[model samples]
Target: MGDHEVLASTGVSELSAPGRCSQGFGVPDLNAWFRVSVWSDQGGMEAIARIRESLTLSGEG
Candidate 1:
């Protein structure tokens, strides 16, 4: 929310097995949330972290 008004939003819940999580963000006049689920039978948490690092978000409004 840099340079923009901050709106209210709920926080992300705890992540369990199967590499899944819910992420949320809020900005002036808007709010959004998303769920990320990464599946891999190997590499464990490191794999999830690596995959997550590659995720990106882009928008214009």
Candidate 2:
């Protein structure tokens, strides 16, 4: 079996409310995710593209 390395990062940002705020409607915002892979050699640097998407409390994709 081979061992797998995993790395994770997170961040939060504040956004302005939409045109109008309803009784229960919340403000609009965004979340981002980035994945990267590092090597032990000096050959070169390699990185994966950044992934950004909307987020919810339920953790649904």
Task: Report the number of the highest-lDDT candidate.
Answer: 1
Query: Candidate 2 local accuracy as lDDT?
Result: 0.26
Q: What lDDT tens digits, residue by residue, belong to model 1 across residues 37-56?
A: 33444544455455455655
Question: Candidate 1: global Cα-lDDT?
Answer: 0.43
Model 2 lDDT tens row, 9-49: 43212134222211111222224333333332321121211
Clashes of each: 0, 0
Candidate 2 has its poorest 10 consecutive residues by lDDT at: 43-52
- What TM-score quantifies how close candidate 1 is to the native fold? 0.35
Q: Which of the numbered candidates is closest to the native, going by highest TM-score? A: 1
Return the clash pairs for model 1, or none. none
Please give the range of 10 consecutive residues that has the lowest summed lDDT in model 1: 1-10
